[model samples]
Target: MSAFTMAASAVGVKVTTTAKRASAKRATAKASSSAFSARKASLNGVSLAAFAAPSVAASKSSQIRALRSAVFAAAKADRSKADDPDAGKGQRVMIIGGDGYCGWATALHLSNRGYEVCIVDNLCRRGMDDSLGFNSLTPIRGIHERVRKWKEVSGKDIELFIGDVCDYEFLSATFKKFEPTAAVHFGEQRSAPYSMMDRTKAVFTQTNNVMGNINLMYAIKEFAPDCHLIKLGTMGEYGTPNIDIEEGYLTVEHNGRTDTLPYPKQGNSFYHLSKCHDSTNMIFCTKAWQMRTTDLNQGVVYGVATEETMMDPALINRLDYDAVFGTALNRFCIQAAVGHPMTVYGKGGQTRGFLDIRDTVRCIQIACDNPADKGEMRIYNQFTEQFSVNELAALITEAGKKIGLDPQVINVPNPRTEMEEHYYNAKNSKLQDLGLEPHLMSDALMDSLLKIIIEYKDRVDKSLILPGVNWTESASVGQQLEKAEKVKA
Candidate 1:
């Protein structure tokens, strides 16, 4: 053969080899895509086994991301078909703790806004009231009655699932079936006093709060990684920091290096500690699984009425004024109604963030309408105003006087082991920027809330108004105080 003929032959072989490799790459990509689709089909109860599952020839991270994306897409399609025709127009959201104080109100709020809502709860908080021999100052209807009343009042439907989130199988099934566009999580134990009541209560709180959230994160990853998880974290997670608290992260400069990290947490109670743990888990998951999350570090929620909740009497939300579940203002207002003096703990200088219930619902709506990007963990300080315990008591006293309740403010020995004085300047601009017109604490709101309290005054148990749980090692301090008050009487 001539030299030119040999070179031409070599060039032809090289071209054929290059073409073959390109063909192989295309085949691999196709196989990987098909295997992912088949897995998704199987998950959604579609039998697509005829397509052989092939090992995805991609990086480990790429394969995982692809699998998650496919699973979520299939789940979303399945959920869309199961929902009402109108549900497709609006985003479908699931509330994991949909039966509690905030959860119930949020369901009604979102439903009124035309979003499809599914509420999941095991009624553990209600059970806690029974276990602690405390009841809401206001009469609360059962979940079934509440849902029925919501439907009757607004002509909107809210799907309810009665189950524990700690049950992974149950949660997984719910996620698969609902395929929510977002999840508003409020399903954990939320009381600091209750958690510190006893060793058993402490263990239950930690396990219930942490494990349930972990299970939720896993279920989201496996079923719907794209679902924006809007967790109801407490401002208590940041405690009473001396420095101004950032939204959810802080920037540090050390050794000529600057890095941004999650804000330093200093939760004052076991309940708050559990929330910090959840935040850590979420941050890890956001990085490891590329999951999207929004942690709304909410302050103490006050007030009762919302647009949807006020539609009917039966649709009213639960109002707790006991030491365990009741907030400062709620308990104070109820106290004034029953002619009991406002029991201010310590010097009552403990200041914290606050928001009206009406605003809380609004904030959630804003968060839902605007979702976080994949692998992004968004945090919003979710309160409109701030007040010290003394200021709240004074406000309640002034309102009580207006209603002829003759409320008096009295200072009592502090039951819990928190600071009476601390700096709390947490930035809460994120939610406001999202167009949250805050309902500031005003006398009109106070008067309205007092009227309801007065109407339910007959049902108020004065005995349950006092603290039952002490944060210190000696749990009997609260009991001792109760006995002393009884003797003084």
Candidate 2:
């Protein structure tokens, strides 16, 4: 009989198996019925980023195919403690959008912890955001330049790829070439306002986000079936829910029949709707193909930099404060830089889960090491705290005033479509159980981000702060406001 059957027959005793095939790790939950919680007290940190992912310079496309195949075959074999990311030996990791904000930081953070990392992107943001005449407030260097800087600082080379995930051939080729043991995907169009601005933006979101993700799954199965995939999904995918968010799944009783299913996603805008579509597609693939995947329904992430990027100004990734891609905290901090009042949309009572970039790295690392079983899919709500937009704006105003910026708070006519105020509560316990001690969005972290903006205040383009992306509700109002936001290219 299988070990699973043995555990089932043990009667009131749970048998857990690890890569080591050691004793089960469990604790009886506080439930009256069949409830069990599993915990791993210690997981070795992945120690591969600097030397692992970028094993060697890419040879010409015509060569090194055999070497790449060997590496991939090794990755697909049943894993052991030696390959565990948590073992302080870090996995060979690939971050699809490693040049983007969260992706860059995550790549570096894991590298510092000893994981080998490779970044893949088509620089699509440059294409999309440039057309809108907005630039990420801080200048972003190309991937080659970034790899050079990383090597100079940490004596490591983060493999770089100028490939598009939307292209199945490129994606499949990269997976075969790198043979990464794990991948963290954060490449997606992520702007609610922009997606609602026009049909083109909406179509772009749907086409690019879904296709890119689907391609990744296909490539993983074809090239490296054992690699763990930790994909970044937005909390906005859940929209403004009335109940506490469960960790990726929920149980409901319908007609006295109870079943657990993926939580209902209530997306508000086109961008968010695409993320919801992504989760649905990922779930279908994971269950059908027995692929290992972790969907992190993360909330809006704040804070300026992580432990990795602060190493040097040259190492910093894109920091967008304009309306197009700017998140709330980033935008508010930028407004303070230009002496502009914090822009409050509508009544500004919409609440969202928020996380610091530092904790974001921790969360990602934890998920990578402790993957779901082959036939089991797990989801985690990735957020630490919740705050309304108004509350956050007030905090920025207060923080800016202390720095002598005297930043004001202005109630702007919300150009795009969304609920101004809504309920949002999500559960994020599974990650904690996996040993994630979260880093809260402390005011100190806020100040750190603000001070970075302070140093770069001269580079602040106040005009880009609001691109006036409008929705059906206020399309005409947005036309007039759009003229006010573009200062220059």
Candidate 3:
């Protein structure tokens, strides 16, 4: 007997030899005719009571028909539940750029909270790290492996779609398939220094960021019109306006007129300018198409581990400490780990809002829970506290000493053209009013970061710590242009 036949026989399935095949085929034909009638009846919504009635003969075929009808009804009910917006399953959220830092953590956070989460990413952030010849200080797993590990640890599944949001075909197809109730957009070039590297990079940053956002707006309008769009904007979009920074809009009192308008934007870098463009496009889409959107103008997110990321080694998120992608606090913590001087640019008086990564994920959840009204564009300043560069370096120094490390702080020439000191208060009451409890930066948190960095000190590259890209230089022209061309190609 063939192996297949032997296996079938072991499982109580009749395995006929050539001699008995003809008889088996005849019997199967009769059974198939009966099975087809049962399936047809089930699909037509025939009453199961008829099958269960004592007046009807309870043959083997009758039992099969009843079972089929019951299974079909149950499956139909499940589909209805999944499709209903009022159903709990309607909490489906599609996270664009869900493989990156904030994206990855938010994906897991929502998944842990019983939201049906799906991640859409092109893995361009990982490609950028490859181009820069550096990796996250803490090793990160591949996107496929990361999601797999999350499933293993949490017993929850987060769907993954590998595609760029700029590709409308792919993005629209995924949107249709997922049918998300809320879409969280983190799919854009996020680094200011990287955007300022050269002409090609600057152009690429704006094109990628702006085009992807436009595509997303249309995709939501076309496929999932009711889908709430939660876009991750930057605090840098406002720059250092002399006046107090409101959440997203500022009221103006002009000559004999008063109206609310979008806050004046003074974006500092090409990347921040791209964000400004995205905000404008999002606002336009909301008004033009009656689409709901929540633009989160978030601050500098610090720390690596969230409750979900720490569950498994493969689930760990990326930690960037290079000048190109690292934030001030992260760089200081890593610099102290490798016994390198914490390089504070100029007088280090440039202040900006900051938040913990844990809070970052929580804020996203709050936005998802409380969606904006139709035709409304809501903006929330997403940060817990404000800290200057000097304050961050000092905190790192204090934390380092407690762990028996002598962390030295030094001032370096400022690479960017900006004020060293300025007024920096920004309102962040919207999320707090919506029940978002913030996590303040503390010595304990800093100490935990130091300990983690010490464990991964072997992976730190001291050479990439300091600022390299100068904002004063013009766009690349000669050999730099050629290199940029190759990268573009």
Candidate 4:
């Protein structure tokens, strides 16, 4: 203070020690004000000079406080924008394999929520029905017809692209043309029994699921690096572990060391193995290329109708009750409706996760609304509830009795090799935490399924309802040789 006073005296301004100290404080405040002005300009696009310039007569403390408040407000606004899923309205979403069960409903749901939706499918799921000599228990229209009907009913258009995801050229072209904000991939061979049928089918399943996913990753990298990849993985990838299943990873402490690693995978079939491969590749893409991905390890999806799928008869979704494609609950309800015994495999103790088709579409929307961060590979176990085969049969039996129908339960040899009885608990809190309200299984849902089945009862192929593909049997020698020759060629 004495030095400040001496300097002031030399400058021809007489000042007391207190006056000198006060003068120095004013200069420091002025400097801080200038710095804050610059920071405020940079923090948000607004310049304090244009709107809330500090008055010359204002106290230094008040000025500083005002500037700090403005900066904090701006930063908070930015975070709110980033986290709001509503910010994604009117953005584009490309649904690969949108003609299929989960994809179809999700496409409509997103479109209804104000998204521009387009579907990319090769009509292979329909082709599979032809090749198998069976059709869905409920008749479904062609993709073109379905989309047209959707437009008529909802007054919203969904663009259709007819091509296979395995074809890179087609996939790349679709990506370039659409330039999607997100891509929901349901383009995979999804049947475990079908994949286990023979060598040819197994090879095709691996090639289609694994190669198609790889192609999608590369296409997204090239065309839309920022696009979120929402892939439909399977709970079958985890199989039936003795311990409770974690979402996608596990933290381990081994030999006095600890690290978090991917949960150990024990896929039960070739189809499930293909899903495991997809998960590995997805993790690599995120780490190497800073790509964003969300792998939904989904449970067995039940029910046939979502809000969108029920809008019109032409917009009806497929109800598969065949052993190859149908789920346990769906098959049970159909069996109950048709006066056939509910087939429970191996003591009816095999348990797995389950969810409604309505929940399936909603989960997809939730994933899209809350995308993963860049270089982040998010994993969610997408299911609402868990039930054993025996439990499903029992529930259906009760529902069937209330509707004046006789339902019987019969235990058959398990076709697939798995734990007949074991501990089954999986964490499904992530989806619910992200605002997913699930539709739990109930008698009303079962009754609705029975009514639909009764309407289309004649379409049910009783012959296809029984298990055919046995996991214990190996592929024929001719089939293996043929596959080998094809590989050589």
Candidate 5:
């Protein structure tokens, strides 16, 4: 007799060898009633009823415990499949700000990887461009056209939902209909310069970012509580500090005590401040409601080409170089292409973390593949390299020189009040351990980016590059608006 049979015999239970083995099989098959029925129907050509009858003398509690063990074994099998690439073959993913820069790229990346992707966007980014009197230097295709092009290129259909995340009704309805397994949230005002442009923008940023996140959390809680949330946080949430910045926490030793807390945030702009607020609410959600979230505190993403975007011209991602939405390195690439000077602000010693756009999508994929546990909030500082403003300008200038553009580098007065030079170091080993091979900034990469910019240089509106949005309190808002109007005209 096996150990199981011996144990049952020792329990003062009348058990034959056949019945003992059948009881074990029944317990393992309890995950499904049909499986249990099939296993219990026979045992070594004998009916299970022979042993399961009340006269068999097995306790009801023992039978119950055996069934519980089967259920747990089945659950463990299901969880083991979560890490497989084929596991997400039929799972749905919803991209909240799918029409914008990061969202569009991520949508394509996920879609190509065999996920059912649905994109929800209000197109507020484009609307903001209209209000600010500038546009992406490269003409971005309309949503319909972009989606159509993607389908043509890859034969993968991506569903589009035109709506605002702030509208709770719309979000709830979306959550009900799609029932996504994962959500990538990029649906908020993202530009610091735009948020600080005026009081109205500042308020709008807070309302839109904070409320949208809240509604999303509630929608998930009510409709798809098990869905993993991959929120796009910003590195700007933690401003330059004297000490090395950890992923999302700092361990401090005080008088006879030690505590680990969320790293202190000192966002210089209202947009980043809104992100800080979002972080707090997410932490609360995980603690209070057992929600799962992975907040990617990403750095300034540069470069425009991705594996999908480079496949076809129509699928090109948005490339912005204006004062409001553009990053420093992207703006530098466009300036070099258009024969404009690489505008370095102040002493140009301001340093920031950056990653190529390709890595951005890859990082999101890694996040989805490795989900956070329920009641856990995982944070990853998403960047590969760091460079100062002057260093980036020099790199762009040199790349331009090699291509015969010979780009001019000029020092411009800093428009925003920020640290021109600061001590900065941040740890980012978490994502690296999860299999993210970063695409570093290289001359060949710059050469490829410049080539694309040169193709669109003819569409460059030099005047629109510098909108007169002053950050200093002493600067007259009226004068700034008037100057912007003149430039627009």
Candidate 6:
């Protein structure tokens, strides 16, 4: 063939090859897989998998740039307007830990603000309830039932998924599916007492909390790079420090060099240590990958119900009172319900920050709508006030007395190695500026919690309410079992 004819043939082959390759890429992006998520994620980006910034260059054709721009724009908008402290609707949000107390409460708060919401959880709380004999300190419904009730009450439909976060396939699949603008992850083992229950519990806490976070970051990278991640951290990770607590970030003027470390997590127990590990791993990955993350350094949450949860019994979440999964507040509520005195661990002067359940949800939603930029890991201290064990007992006692029932305050020997008395000066201006109005632990909220428990009063088992799980120390599993046998003998 002539030179021109040969050149023309080569050009034709190149065009055909490139076009075929593009077609295959589109096909790959369009493929969808089954998700183990019981509350299946919506099909927003389920067909398209996530890619990184470096790879994005190669993928950034005019067509791909448009998609990227759109995704980034949506993410940016959600973060910028999430908290308008001026009293208005919040940003659209999806909560990964929406199955838990804070998670459910946060979901409801956002929904009230008219923000779109989707929740995904593996029903770990349900499993815990099943393993133990008693149910949530209050009547609880399954995931589907709860979602349905929310719909009935508010005419809003919250997309939900019941699946494990550690499952990368499932995590990625759900991320692609939801195309969520922002995500609040609360899915982790969160009890120091339980983590210290035994070695198995310790191992489970370590693996589950850390791995779940790792998997979540990976899923965000794989399925939604531009999506914002808001995570719940703990003040216990910082321990009872002599220094004042700065919400999530700290500034240092060093020797001609300055760097803000993650407030140096001096974790107290396995569970708190696991959260520290989670934050550490997250900071590393988020910085390396330029993923935006917000870590909420939250304190102990109290109070019974949110505005929505209080509106109906069916709308309430699993009100756990068991030692394995319950928080101090919920446990206290259950104690009041069963006519048992609140058990205050020894040296009840341990003061920590506290927030009502409604505030916990509000703080989480605020984080969601405020995405940190690339190379930024935003941190916020999520609490309104501080209270000691004795202080909380006094409040509970006063409220219980008003109801014509005396709620005793028993001094139980401390189980964990926490400071019974120490300094707890924490600043939480970020969330407040983000328009989070604080809800105090009011007598009304306590009454509501007590009333909810009263509905399920017959279901409360007074025997298994308290299990002395020592987290500050350890005894072998065999030794523990032998001791139990000896007790029986």
Which tens-of-lDDT digit does each residue in 204-322 have in candidate 4? 99999999999999998888787889999989899888888999999999999999989989999999999999999999999999987999999999888887788888888888888
Instruction: Tell how far residue 449 is off in model 5, in angstroms.
Output: 0.5
Error of 5 at 146 (Å): 1.4
Off by over 4 Å in 6: 1-92, 253-258, 472-476
The TM-score obtained by model 2 is: 0.79
TM-scores of the candidates in the order shown: 0.79, 0.79, 0.80, 0.80, 0.80, 0.78
Between the candidate structures 3 and 6, which one is better when assessed by lDDT?
Answer: 3
Winner by lDDT between candidate 4 and candidate 3: 3
Q: Give the alpha-carbon lDDT of every model.
A: 0.79, 0.72, 0.82, 0.81, 0.80, 0.71
Q: Show the colliding residue pairs in model 5.
A: none
Query: lDDT value for candidate 3?
Result: 0.82
- Shift in Å, residue 227, candidate 1: 0.7
lDDT of 4 at 332: 85
Worst 10 residues of 6 by lDDT: 31-40
Q: Model 2 misses residue 31 by how many Å?
A: 26
Model 6's C-alpha root-mean-square deviation from the true structure amounts to: 16.3
Score candidate 2 by lDDT. 0.72
Write the candidate numbers in order of decreasing lDDT: 3, 4, 5, 1, 2, 6
Candidate 1 lDDT, 347-385, residue by residue in tens = 899999999998888778767755676788999999999
lDDT of 5 by residue, 1-489 (tens): 242233223333222332342233233223333442454343312334534676856666665566546544543443344323333354467999999999999998777766668999999898988877888877789998999998777666789989998999999998877777778999999999888877778889999999999999999888877777889999999998888989998899989899999999989888999999999999999889898799999999988899788788888888889877888887888888887788888889998889998889888877776667789999999999989999999898888889899788888889888899998898898876555667999999999899988988888889766534557742246766776799999
User: Over 4 Å off in model 4, which ranges?
Assistant: 1-88, 477-489
- For 113-210, candidate 6 gives per-residue lDDT tens digits of 55667898988866765764646656667778888888777666689988998888888888776666567888887878778877887898899899
RMSD in order of candidates: 18.8, 15.8, 17.7, 18.4, 16.3, 16.3
